[model samples]
Target chain A: MPSLLHHPLDPASRIARLMLAEYGVPVDLEEIKPWLREAEFLEVNPAATVPVLIEGDVIVAIGPLASIHAIEDSYSPEAVAGLFPTDAAERAEMWRLFEWVAVKFNDEVTRYFIEEKIAKRDQRGSTPDTGVLRAAKANLHEHILYFNWLAATRRWLGGDTMSLADFALAAHISTLDYLGDIDWGTAADMRDWYSRIKSRPAFRTLLNDRVIALPPQKGYADLDF
Target chain B: MPSLLHHPLDPASRIARLMLAEYGVPVDLEEIKPWLREAEFLEVNPAATVPVLIEGDVIVAIGPLASIHAIEDSYSPEAVAGLFPTDAAERAEMWRLFEWVAVKFNDEVTRYFIEEKIAKRDQRGSTPDTGVLRAAKANLHEHILYFNWLAATRRWLGGDTMSLADFALAAHISTLDYLGDIDWGTAADMRDWYSRIKSRPAFRTLLNDRVIALPPQKGYADLDF
Candidate 1:
């Protein structure tokens, strides 16, 4: 059985979980605060980041990007063809959108919203700085608008067929939505897209994720919303 | 023919350039400062990132990771079998090391060093902040130690066969070396590994790169060093 070391709210961890679920691969999940840098966890991933997937002897995939790729590499394309496109051009676009979410979206929104807004308040018991949250919200609007453009134009984030890009974007958006950081009313196209993905059986694990002291927003777990 | 928008010192751009050369794929390189965020370049990649590869009509690979993946996707595996491993396990490791250099190393060392010590100086005529450069150097030393361990153990960074990990790593180290930021004396094993890769025909173009206003260090182009 594969095991995943991850954090509940981490978008990267969410990406791994979504991939595993989408591929119908079951894995044991162990939550770890990588910032704590536990000695045991450090042995798994020296970088002390989450979503480290350990499968079989001598097979460990560290970091978010690696973990996701590891899953894709292992699964037969026939079993999970939706995650990776078959056409060369589509594959390139899939990778592009994947990076857009992983690197660009992460830097612009996740670092500010999750790291500063949510993590700080949850872990450190610190007050969320309005200035940082404000900037992240502003960035989120632009990202949401761009995502809306992608959604409105295409059937999926990456292309006509769903791919890792959809999961990546949903992973980030899910976290923000859980924090009540998104204005869904203003994001009709995004809302429609998220609703479709949110209703998937693979998303059940994510929707069920709950932080004891910090509960999710009202519609976070609602399928219709 | 492919066209690559790259910046000489940018590690991501260097990775793209190296991958293209290693694969024997020639690309017309047009240096672009992403920070300028030119409208034309923004159309190529809205993120305003370098290393955008446009190959024929309707095939555009944005960002470094995508550009590399694009080349791998388009070309026959036999043509450039070294870039991506055939075995699933080896491929996973290959990607792990690739991400290690792209995301982790770039964030910890390259971003600080390039942004503070190089880009800021080049763009704003600002003096390099010694404190930031000092911190980046310290981070680089730790990274070098890790790379040395990898080189001492494995025949290549990914495994016995040279992989994209080697190129990704060399891409960053080459830039830092050009800046004279690395203390090669403390990195004997890493130096041995780098020299082998540095001597490749593909690396010649990178070595020959000259920014007239910002010349490289004395030993930058010297493989014997």
Candidate 2:
């Protein structure tokens, strides 16, 4: 079995965990606060980040390897058809949306929210910055509108087939949802899309994850949600 | 033939340009100021970002697709073996370093530097922020050290063969070098590694790219520095 060093609320960690589960690859999860920058953890991942997957002798420290692409590389498309498409054009589309959530959404929304809510508490025990939270929320709404547009047009985030695009998106959205930051009512299409991804068996562990200091929103783990 | 929408000094755009050149792919480059958010450009990429690659009907908006992977997908390994490895493990390492340069390096160093030096000029004609430039330079040195370590250990950034990892690192470094920000003396190993990459025929266009308002460094296009 592989072992993954991750944090409960980390969107990147969530993506890795979700990808592994979707691939039906069992992994032991070890929670670590990356900000602590533990010496041992640094040995495993010099970058000092979470979602460092150690599978026997192979250690994957970056997003491209620890996320969907890694699983796609390891398993055949026959076993996990929808995870990645066989066609080059579809795969290109998948990479585009996957990166949109991972890079754009993560930088504009999630990082700011995390800095205000989580990092401040851990590092300085400071109060969350209202200005930062407001900016993040505004940015979040813009991204949600984009997601709503995609959901209204396509069957899944990438295309007709469910792919890494959906997982990358759900991972980030789920983390925000855990903080009760998302207003599902804002976009009915986005809500429907999230509901479909949230109900997946691969998402069960993430739904069960409990951050002791910050409890999840009421509907976070609800299947009907 | 393909077309690339890009800005001269944009690191992401540079990566796409270099990768396409490396693959022996012909592309018509269209320079665009992404911040202007042109309606037609946004139609192809809602993000309104540069480095959008258009081949036939396919439009790749994000960096991951428009850069190295896009070229890799279009061409075969037999035609361009070293750009992307055929082996899974080597490919994983290739993706790791590629992301390290694209995401971590770009975020920590390139974006701040560009904001202070380039974006401000285009937007408000404001003077560069000394504090922001100072922080970016400080962050840049740390990344240079890491690059130095990688160059000293591996034959190439990824491993024995030159891969997308080298192009990604070179892309960011070249942009910084164009601004005369990088101290080549500080990291001899990184300097040597960069020299090797710079001398390549694929790097010719980037070396010749002169941002009209910002002149290149004295030794910007020099092969033997």
Candidate 3:
């Protein structure tokens, strides 16, 4: 089994965990408080980001891309079915959607939330400004609308197959959902897509993740949600 | 010829331009001002980021990954020798550095410059905050320090060979260098690596780039610098 240094609240870490579970790759999870500024953690990733994986002598640190690459390399195709499309075009599509969520959505949503809930607390700052939160909320709605369009057109964000893109996106959305930031009523197609992804066995660990007093939304664990 | 929708000042776009030049791929470059909030540009990328590429019917949007993927798909290997290593491990290492420069460094440094120079000017009410600028300048020192460490250990950031990582990183550093932010005296090895990259044929266009009023550093165009 490999070892994973991660933060429970981190969407990127959750995405990696989901990938590992999806591939049936057991990993020893070590919770890393990125805010604490640990020297050991910094040595693994000078960027101080989460989802760092240690496999034997190799240390792969980054976000979903690193985890996805690791999973692809370590597992047989059959083990992680539908996680990564093998076809060239499909693989490109998968990468496109993954990038969409990882970069765009993460930039618009997760960064704000983490800074507000975690960083602010550590720094003993006043609560996050409503102006920023309002902007993020609006941006997230637009992102959901885009997802609605993609879900309505393609069976999954990437294409007809459920790939790592779906998991990568859902991981972020789920984290927001835990914070009660997502307005699922904005898009039916997106909601349906989320429902499908949320119910997967791979998502169980993520859904069960408890972030102290930040209890999930009422229907966060509901499969039918 | 492939079409590239980009803004010259955008580091990611410049990196793509360098890659295209290095690969000898003919690309029709179209200047895109993302700040203009054009509908068509938004359609291609809702985030309104630059460096989006149009290859036939497929729209490859985003930064280094998309640019690299496009180059890998379209270009001949011999034209850009060793720019994108084909070996899986070597390629992964290349991507790691590419991601660092394109995303991490860009976010930490370039975005602040844009915010100060352009974004503040456009949104006149939001004056350029000296505090943010100071932080960006301070943060850059740490980044340069890390680069120095990498330069001391490896021939290139990726390894023994010059790879996409070099181009991706140099593209941003060159932009910062143009702004006179880099302290070359701090890292002689890093400076030497950069001088070699800066002298490459692919870097000619970058050397010629002129941002009004914010002139390049005194030695920006000098290969011997």
Candidate 4:
């Protein structure tokens, strides 16, 4: 079993956790404060981000993108079938969506929420900045509209089968969803898509994740959500 | 021949250009101002990022990550051999370095330089913030030290033969070098490694790049610094 150094609400960490669990790879989770730049954590990943996958004493990979490639390569391809689309074009689309959700979505929305809401709370940094949160929410609305279109049209976020693109997105959105920042009401197709994915067995662990003083929003763990 | 929608100094775009050229894949480059969010560019890449790869009449991939995968998959593996390593562990390390250079390094240093120096000039936004430039330079120093160590130890940035990790990093560092931010005197190993890479035939295109009102620093296009 690999040991994973992660933060409960970190979207990148959530993506790794979801991928590993989905592939039935058991991992031990060690929660860390990445902002603190703890020497132990920094030793494993000089970049100091997570979730870092470690096998025995050797650290394997860092961040969501590396973790995805690491997981696909290291794990049995047969077991991780649905994690990647088979068709050439679909796989290309999968990487594109994966890049968008991991980079653009996180940059415009999820990262701000985490830094303001979660990191501030943990480190006693400051009250969550209303101005920043407002801007992030506005950005979130645009992303949701785009995602809503994808959800309404594609069978899966990457097409045909649920892939890493779906997990990459779910991980980020779920964090925002937990923080009560998402207005699921306006995201009809995205909401419908979430309901289907939210009910999956791989989603079980994410539902049970509780951030010390910050409990998830009402109905966050519910299948009917 | 494919068409690459890119900007000269944009690190992501440069990475794509480097890879295509190194692999002998002829591509027609159409430079765009990504900050403009032009509808044509957005129609091709809704994320509105540069380095969008198009084949025939359809857009294939976006960003450095997608471009790397698309190139490897689409091109003959024999022609693109050195872009990836044969060893599994080395390949994993390649992705790790690729992720760090593309994401962490960009967020910390390169993007700030582009946003402040280039984008502001083009967008007619405002004068470059001295405070931001100071912080970015400080971050760049730290990154250069880390990269210097890697250059001193490894055969290449990602180990053994030159790989996409080297291109990913060179694309970024070269831009900052062009901006006259890099102190070549201080980064001995990195400078030596870069000198070797800079002299390659694939590097010729980058050497010839120029912005309207901005000429590169001394030795910017030189084979010998």
* Best prediction by TM-score: 4
Q: What does candidate 1's lDDT look like per residue over B1-225, in tens digits?
A: 888889999988998888778778888888898877889878878878778887665547888767887777775357446688887777778888888889889988998887876678656557888898888888888888899999999889988999889999999999988888889898888899999999999999899998767889989999898
Q: What tens digits encode model 4's per-residue C-alpha lDDT throughout B45-151?
A: 88878888898988788765677788877774564376877777777788889988988899999999999999999655489999999999999999999999999
Docking class of 1: medium
Q: Scoring only chain A, what TM-score does candidate 4 earn?
A: 0.96
Residue A189 alpha-carbon offset, candidate 4, angstroms: 0.6
> Candidate 2's residue-wise lDDT over B161-206, tens digit each?
8887898899899999999999999899999999999999999999
Put down candidate 1 lDDT per residue, A1-225, tens digits, no spaces: 898989899999999999999888898988887777789978777878778888765546888877887888775357446587887778778888888899888888887877775567646557878898898889988989999998999999877898888999999999988999989999899899999999899999999999878899999999887
Candidate 1's C-alpha runs over 4 A off are: A56-58, A77-80, A121-125, B76-80, B121-125
Clashing pairs in 3: none
Error of 2 at B203 (Å): 0.9
Candidate order by decreasing DockQ: 1, 4, 2, 3
As for candidate 2, its interface RMSD to one decimal place is 2.9
In model 1, which residue pairs have backbone atoms overlapping below 3 Å? none
TM-score head-to-head 1 vs 3, winner: 1
lDDT of 1 at A89: 71
Candidates ranked by TM-score, best first? 4, 2, 1, 3
Q: A1-225 in candidate 4: lDDT tens per residue? A: 998889988988988888888878888999998988889878778888887778998767776566777877777457437577777777888888999988888888998999899888766547999999999999999999999999999988977888889988999989999999889889989988898888888888999999888999997998887
lDDT of each: 0.85, 0.82, 0.78, 0.86
TM-score of chain B of each: 0.94, 0.93, 0.89, 0.96
lDDT of 3 by residue, B37-114 (tens): 789887777667777777787775454455556566667475446576766677667766777777788778888987
